[model samples]
Structure formats: C-alpha cells, structure tokens
Target: MEEMMRSELVSMSSYCRRYGHLKLHDFSNPSFKKTKYSPTKVFVVSSSSSNSTSPPPLPQNPIFQSFFFPVTPSPIIPYLQHCSRNTKKRKFTPSSSSGSVKVISREAFNAAVKKPSVAVKKPTVAVKKPTVAVKKPIVDVNKPTVAVTHDRGVRKSSSWVKSRLLGKGGYGSVYLATSKDGRYKTERAIKTAELSRASSLMDERRILKRLKSPFVIYCYGDEIVREGTSDCYNLILEYCSGQCLADVIEDNQGGLSEFDVKLYAKDVLSGLSYIHDRNIVHCDIKPDNLLLTPVDHRFRSNGFLTKIGDFGLAMEKGSVEYGNGCGHKRGTTRYMAPELIGHGVIDFAVDIWAFGCSVLEMLTGVQVWGEHGDLVYDDWVSLIGHSDLIPNIPSWLSEEAKDFLKRCFVKEPNARWGINELLNHPFLSSNQVFSHNGFIYE
Candidate 1:
C-alpha cells in the first residue's frame, strides 16, 4: 500500500511540473481563474454515492471532466494524511454542495482536524500596531570607559572640554582638551576619529597604555563621545606645547644647530631604545613624530624636551615572520629605509635608517631625498650596495658627527649601529649629559 502511494505521489509531482497551470475550475464557467495562493494539484470533489463506489472514469480531456461518484476512503484523504503526518498539521474545509469541489489553504490544511467537510471563508485583513518614538540610550556619567584594557584615570567624555584643533590627519584629528575637574592642571591632547576608524585607534590606545617612558608620549585614558547619529573615540595623550621637532626646525630657519640635533636625537634614541627593548618597532620615525615638550624647572633651559609620538605604524618585531620577499611598505616616504622601499626584510634597522635621515635633515635643513637638490632612485640603489653615495654631509658638522650618521646609514641592516651605540657616540655626548635617570646610559 505504501509503495503504491509513493508511485502515485511521484506521478502527481511529474504532472504538476509538466503542467504548472493545471488547476480545478468550474467547467461551466470560463470566467473562473485560480488565485495566487491556489494549490497546483489535488482537486477535491463532493459526491452523494456510497463510500464503496469507485470514482467514475476521468475524461480524457480534463477541461470537460465532471465528478459522478466518490471512491472508498477517498484517494486524496490517504495521500493528504500521509503528507500531513510527514509535515505539519493544516486546516482544511470541504465545500457545502454535494457535487461541488473545494480548495483549502496550506494554513487551513495544517490547522484542520479529521472531520466531515465544511465551507471555508476567506481570510480577513489584519490591523497594524501604532509606532512609538524611541529614546536614545542614556549613558551613566559616572561610569568609566573600559576598553581591551582598563585604567583608573579613564573618565567620561563629558568631563573634558574640547578647545581647539591641534592637528588633523588620515586617522583623524587631535584636539586640545582640558578637564572640568580642578585637580587636572595640565592640558591634554585628545586624538579622535569616527567609529569606522576604531580599530587602529583602539590598537594605539592599548599600546600607549602598556608603554612607560619619559621619551614616549604619555596616554591618560580614552572616552567615546556621542554625536548626532554616530559616535567618535577620543584618546587622551600628554600635550607638548612646544610642538613637533619638524615645527621647531622650521622655526629655526630650516635647520637646527648641531648641539640641538644631538640633544633631540638623544631623546629620540632613548625612546627607540625603550621601544626596541620591548620588541616593538617605531616604523614611522620622523621629525613630525618627535614631539617637543617645554623643559620643566628641573631641566631649566630654553631648549625643549623631545619625545616620540604617533605610534599608529608601530608593530611587534616577532609577531609575524616574513618570508624572503618585500613586505608591505609603511612609514613616511622621505624617511623610508631602502629595504622598506624595496619591500625587503623589515626589522628594528628600518627605524635606525629613518633616524639617520631625520638627523641629516636636522643638520643640513634638507630632505633625505632632496639632499643634493637632485635626489634620484639611482642614488638609493647605489647606497644599498655600500657605495659611498651618502646624503650630503654639511662641512660645518664635525667628522665624528658625520661618521656617526654613516654608521646609521649602513646599507646592511645587521651592520647598522643600534640605539644604544648611537646614543654613546661622541656627537650626541658633546651636548647632552647622560646618567640622569640611568635609563638611557645603562
């Protein structure tokens, strides 16, 4: 019986596929059409004949067919029962007229119980609920921001007053901010970006919190400020009123005195030493990234203190091993090492190369690429081979200072002197006194 039922089901499916428009309609009425939700197969019919009677022979042309009698156990009932058992319960109702056929919706079929057929009414229209205004999420002003890491000083954005725009770049902008709290004396520089730029900014904030060095910019905390629709992130960092080393050079008629260069370079090297010791590389080391803070009373002098800033391009040295190929080029173009430009193996030496370029620019008041006023790729290629094609060394700079730069400019990364060696060089030693904190001297 099961096998016979399966064969009938397969045949019915085939028929539906062959004639998708096949549907039961009143043969006496040509105007009748099927509805959008009408079933494709299995037309039902009512008969006054006994249950033991077999259905009358189906006409060869279905368009002219008419039901004469009903078969025992109605062939459709067993099939529909099997289908309903295999699937879900559905509601169904048979037509009232003794010889009329009925169509039931899938929903009606699923909801129906086994009983005598009855007329089904059309579904009614449903009313929708009224909309209500949604309020913005209320933030607890007392709650502190807790990111990937947490610190005690983290506070709400409302507590800080954003003053003027300090600077702006691809990552976003830096604004001068002051705390409303009287305990906060010094102004803070808040680096901000839209939520779309959260990843890089968040990474920087995490890194800043882990670092603790006098030469590196200090991070206080972070906060999220809500705009009309979108939110923005604000990273609080130590503000350097004296500005960047690049600006300082511009103020000094495009170049710094040899003494000043040595002093600033020592400060940069101190930061680099601390960073490299922790296995991190400051990939984008340049004058712009070296911020100058005014000398405190302890180091009373007109000279400003240099600190490394802008750690957006920093990366852990051994995080991911690189195969023998050019890695992605990162960092300022003018300060890029030859290997960095060629997509060669990158390491701490790249920072050393950039430091050399920065030092040269400070002394000569010229760009690394514009050293001879006619810089070219060929010059870089020659330098990569240990050729004596160094950047133009000013005659005013002592030979010791020139030699110290040459050591930093060595094409072979392994041959280049590191931060510790560079710090101890005679040139940097001439102006700066070591052993103050013993951090750099050690």
Candidate 2:
C-alpha cells in the first residue's frame, strides 16, 4: 500500500511539472502571459484516506501551496482548498517517502496532523413534550410596507418587494437591499422625497438617462414609492465607494497637490463633455457630486478617474429655464453660475463654471465663488471678465496646467476649454507608462 501511494504521488507530481504553466502553484505572479501552461487536474491528497493505515505526517503550510498542486487544463481555473489543521504543522508540498518537505520539522508535522476524532459512542438525549403549541406573532396582512431610504438617489433603489432603507439623501434616504427575486438584487442608493417632488425627481431621471460616459457614474434603476407618513418616489443608483473629491480634499487638510488637482480635473471635464455632447447640463457640479472610485489602499491609486455622479439638478438642453428665486435653486450656493440665477438656459456653460470652481477648491481649500453677498455676482463678473479671480496657480503646477485651467475658467463658455483639449494637455500626456505602485510616481 505504501509503495502504491508513492507511485500515485509520483505520477501526480510528474503531471504537475509537465504543465507547470497552467497549474502554476505560485500566487505571486498575476501575469499569465509569462508562460503557456495547460493544467489537466487539481487534487487534494489526504494522507488519512490512503490504503496504508499509517499515513504520513502533514508538512508546514506553504504560502504558495497552489504552486505545488496538480491542475486540470480546463480554461476555468480551480482554486486550491484544504481543510485547516489544528493539531499539526500543515505543509503544502509533497516530498519523497523520507519526509523531505522542508517547510516544517518532522516532529511538528506529526503532532499537528492527527486523525479527526471519531464519534463511536451512542449518544442519546432525554426528550420532553411541550405543554403548549407556541406560535410566532402574525403581522397584519394589509399593513403598508416601509419604503427604501438613502442619502442619495441611484439605480439600486428601484428594486421590487425589498422594502428596506437602500440609502439616505440630503433631501431623502437610500437603502442597500436585495430583492425577493435574486435576479433583482442590487447594491443601491435611493433618494426619498415627498409626493410633491415626484415631478422634479422624474425630470432628473430623464436627464440622467440620456447622458452616457465611462467617466460618469451611471443610474441603474428607479421607482416612485410611499415612505413613512408620505408617498414618495426614490431614485436608485449604482454603488460608488470612494469619498467624494470634497471629502478627499478635506482629508488632505490644506488642499490637493497640483498634480492631483489636474488629474481629478481632467476626469471631471471628460464626464462633463460627455453630458454636454448629449445636450444635458449638470446644473450642479460640486465636490459632493464629483466622485472617485475606491481602490486598494496598499497600492498606488488614481484619483484622476473622477466619476461625476448625482444628476439630481441636471437638465436637458431644451428644458424650461429655472431662475434661483423661482425654483429650488438646484445648485450648491458657491458653485451656482451667474447665468443660472437669471432663469436663462445657462446652457452647458453652467457646468464649465462649476468645473472651474472645483479646480479652485482643489488648489486652495476654499470655494472659488466665496459666499453669497453683494460681491458674489460682482466677483463672478470680475472673474469672468478678468482671469485673475481664479485661484493663483501653485508654482508646482506645470506651464501646461496653467494654460489648461486658464482655458477652462475662461470668462465665456464658448471660449472656455473643451474636453478634447484638456485631455491632450501636457499634464496627462506626460505620463507614458504609469502604475499605482510607483512604476511612475509622477
């Protein structure tokens, strides 16, 4: 039996080495392009199950045990799994009959891998009869269900039969939920509101549906439902995990470095240009709305790919004009544009204005438009009329960054910077080969 066990293991080992590429036990290399391997099988050999009554001891578990395992050549990669060991030193590789797997000492391996305890004793429990037939409390069959709530509206809010808080909004609440039908399951954010605001929420949805871009956060689903004490509609959205650029900046304390500001600003512009091309105007663009995609913190991550989310105040190109006093201001105070207050179409220029504001915020930890006052509009006019009101470019910014932003914050929208120009700008173009892990830190 021992001879047979040795023969079988030898065959397995031979098979693994023959197609090592396909069954690479090494976990360190993620790049599959290094070799052409074809795995044919993956096996978990249990010494306890061998025909030989006296099984070999366990070896110390290797960090890259998969590297030693046999693999099947199927396209579907199979992960190596082993039951955890409690009593013995667990090892990964199979050595010769002399117990040559070097990761662990022979004594430790024997002590660690003892046979599982057997339950041979006949165990019995005394049974008792219940005096009463206890029943669970019944809920009212006709009671209304709770509506999903969220901090914001997003596509995940529109699931059916999942009456739970999906998320919360500054104006409403959101719920993260799963639907009764697994097919409908989604991680979502929903904005809740009184029935009176249904029309506005729908309007926002209409604008959101038409705008598309990889840089923009997408709406997944939506629904109008009744919340506690009031009938309301909820806007569901895709789950985005990173802090808004606002929070990221605040976390940095003083402000973003010049390089990061340019990086984030470029993505913001790309998102805007996509929306504008579709004739949609994001009336509100602020740090809260400009989002970043979360990534592994250990590795270097890009803050540059900012996804523009939350189109609640967005409008289609031909939508009716809304002045500040007449409607729900529809924008953050500081980011609101001069033309937006006049009930004019503000066009795509409003977004450009907001983008400029965001850039200033990124450079200096202050809102570009300052507070609303007599000088507010006057400041905008002067800034729009004269280029100096824009935040002073940090000396660290490149000459190209200075020119790119100068174009973005131009006094006139028509003359302002466009997406293509910004993308091709020197700041982004300079990085030929980049990686989050300092392959190219700059």
Candidate 3:
C-alpha cells in the first residue's frame, strides 16, 4: 500500500510539471473541492523520475522563504527556483488561461524575484512668502473717491463727502469734508479749484508739503479730482473747529483780551519761526488767515489753539514777486509793510509786519488802515507808500505789548525783529492763563 501511495504522488508531480499553467483540482483533499485555484496556495515539489529516492530538500534561500512558506505557497516560487538552478538559457513564458504567453526577459525576471525596496520619505522644505505691489485705483467723480499717497510711501483710497462751504478765496473755495467710510475720524477742509486756475492751490500744496508744525495747519495731501465737466485740484488740510481770529474777535464784540492775544501770538511766532527757518515767507498773515482750533484742557484753558493757515500767498524767501501787473500789490492792502508798498520788496519781514497788523486787529476788532472812506487803491497806495506814518498803537496796551508791536512795525525790513527775536520778548513770556467766555456768533 505504501509503495502504491508513493507511486501516485510521483504521477501527480509529473502531471503538475506538464500542465503548470492549467488549473488542477486537489482530489486528495475533498474539503478544497469547491475552492478556486490560487497561485499563492499551490507550490508543490516531487522527486524526479530519474532519481526517485527522496524528494530534494527545499531551497534554504531567504528570498524563497519570504516569498512562500508562512503564507500558502504559489506555483511561481518553484518555477522561479527552477529558473535560478538551471544552467541552460531559457525564455520564461508566463501563460494566461486564454492560451496567450508573455515573454519576460531574464533581467525582468531577476528584478521581479529580488526584494522590493522600502520607500523613503523626503524632508519638507520651507517656502518664502511673496511680496505684493499696490495698484492705484481710478478716481470716480460720482463717488468722489481719491487715492492719496501718505508720508511713508503707503498708498490708500479715501472718499470725502462734502458738506457746507467753509469759505471762498481767490485761489479756490474751501469746503468742510468728512470721510464717507468713517476711516478718518476728524473733519477736514478741502480747498478746490478748477484745474486751469489751480496754480495757487498747486503752489500752496508744494509749500505745505515742506512744512511740519503743530502751530501750523497740516496738509494731509492733495489730489486732482473731476467735478461735473471740470477737473479740479484739491488740497486736503486739517480743519479748525473754532473759527478764524477775525471771526473770533467779531464774536467777542471787541478786541480779544491781552491774555488771549499773547497766547495766540506765541503760537503764531512758533509757526513763523518754523517756516522762516526754511526760508519761506507767508505774504498774507491777516487775522482772517490765523485760525483757532478747539483744544482740550491739556493744551490751554482758553479752549482754543491758534494755528497759522492759508498759505496760498506764501513763497520762498528770495523768489517773492511784489506785484502781478500795473503796480498792484499781491497781499491785502491793510497789512502791506512799508517796504512792500514803497519798493516792491518782499521777504520774511513782510510777514512780521502783517503779523503786527493782525495783532492790532485782534486787539481793536477793526481794520488796521480803518475804513476805505474816499480812498481808492491808488490813493491808499500813495498814502501808505509815500508817507512815514505807521498804524496807531493803542494807549491802553502795556509797555511790553507796545514795544513788541513797535518791533514788528519797523519801516525798514532790515531793522525789524525776526521771528526768533520776537519770541523772546516779554509780551509772549507771560505765564498767566485766562477763562474763555464761550464764542458768540452773529
């Protein structure tokens, strides 16, 4: 019986070698009768017919062990072992059930038999962020939006909603402007002029760009905007909530108190000093151009901070032209200095002379040259230019105030005290504070 069993196993091995590609049922194991043929479960070996003693021992190769033993065996394992042991060169013909054969090269077969390499994960690298450029937006006249470049080269867009007309001048009309989007908390004054006649506004913008001082009205920036059919040049400036010194005096029903005058004079001098140091001359320095800003207790108890504004008539010190044409003066007639009227000479001293006139008006609440009366422009020119008379300094003023005005009113521009010298005067050195009686508007 044992001899018969060995013979049957030898026949089965021979049958497997002849038809390795065909599916074979395992009749010896009835339990596997219903299972389909799987390559991983079918590695079998038998003694060769020439040497029928004992079946040759399985290969000790780790590659063979990793491919076959622990899991169910595959027919490809013994086929691969045969390929590796055979000395004769033979093509590996892998067949499918459809009777088609695929010829795999020796190198491909070897590569398939070799162990697959484990994949390595690469280290992550950091990428730098890219910088973005800002593009300027197109101005929309209907929306009234403007793209403004600020101090640090940073650009931003702002929309100003125009409200009431603050005032009008020869250069342009000043309007109260508030930010439409609430980005800017404070109210602003926008001075606008038709582009064709915007020379004064342009010049003022250039001059204001160079000036920086708390006592001077600040220029935020300027933009060219379209209004209806006309392109307008707009200058954005700090808005003073109070009023001009002229209006303030009129509201008070008389000249301001000496305390108020000294307080305002100090700030004006400080602003003048800053501009004069840079060789700028404010040709117009009347009370109407000196603006009062509301302030908190930290600044002054008077509820106002005097700031110098209206730089439309200002020019660089040596570049000032005395008249436009036909012997007409550039500034208001009442504040013109003797040198400015007589010789057409203009300099920083003209500002001092006008400042003196403004102080007098603030004290008297009236024009320095009095009413026009019967005097025409030429008549007034003759009277002021040819005569040696100066504006009358009131008798009620203190000696220090009288002396300060005298220094400012000197006929010869060279002899007049400069802004620095006047700042040291006793009139401005007073430390006394006064109470404000609140503004009275007509």
* Number of the top-ranking candidate, with lDDT as the measure: 3
Query: What are the per-model C-alpha RMSD values against the true structure?
Result: 24.1, 40.5, 16.5
**Candidate 2 error regions (>4 Å):** 1-171, 174-185, 295-300, 319-330, 341-345, 370-398, 431-435, 438-442
Strongest candidate by TM-score: 3
Candidate 1's residue-wise lDDT over 243-277, tens digit each?
A: 98777777777587666677788889989999889
For model 3, residues 235-267, the per-residue Cα lDDT tens digits are 899999888998888887668888888888888
Which portions of model 1 miss their true places by more than 4 Å? 1-157, 182-185, 297-300, 320-326, 371-389, 431-442
Superposed model 3: Cα runs more than 4 Å off = 1-158, 183-185, 318-328, 371-374, 431-442
lDDT of 1: 0.69
Answer with 1 or 2, whichever has the higher TM-score.
1
- Better candidate by lDDT, 1 or 3: 3
Taking all chains together, the TM-score of candidate 3 against the true structure is 0.60
User: Which window of ten consecutive residues has the lowest lDDT sum in model 1?
Assistant: 63-72
Choose 2 or 3, whichever is better by TM-score: 3
lDDT against true structure, model 2: 0.58
lDDT of each: 0.69, 0.58, 0.72
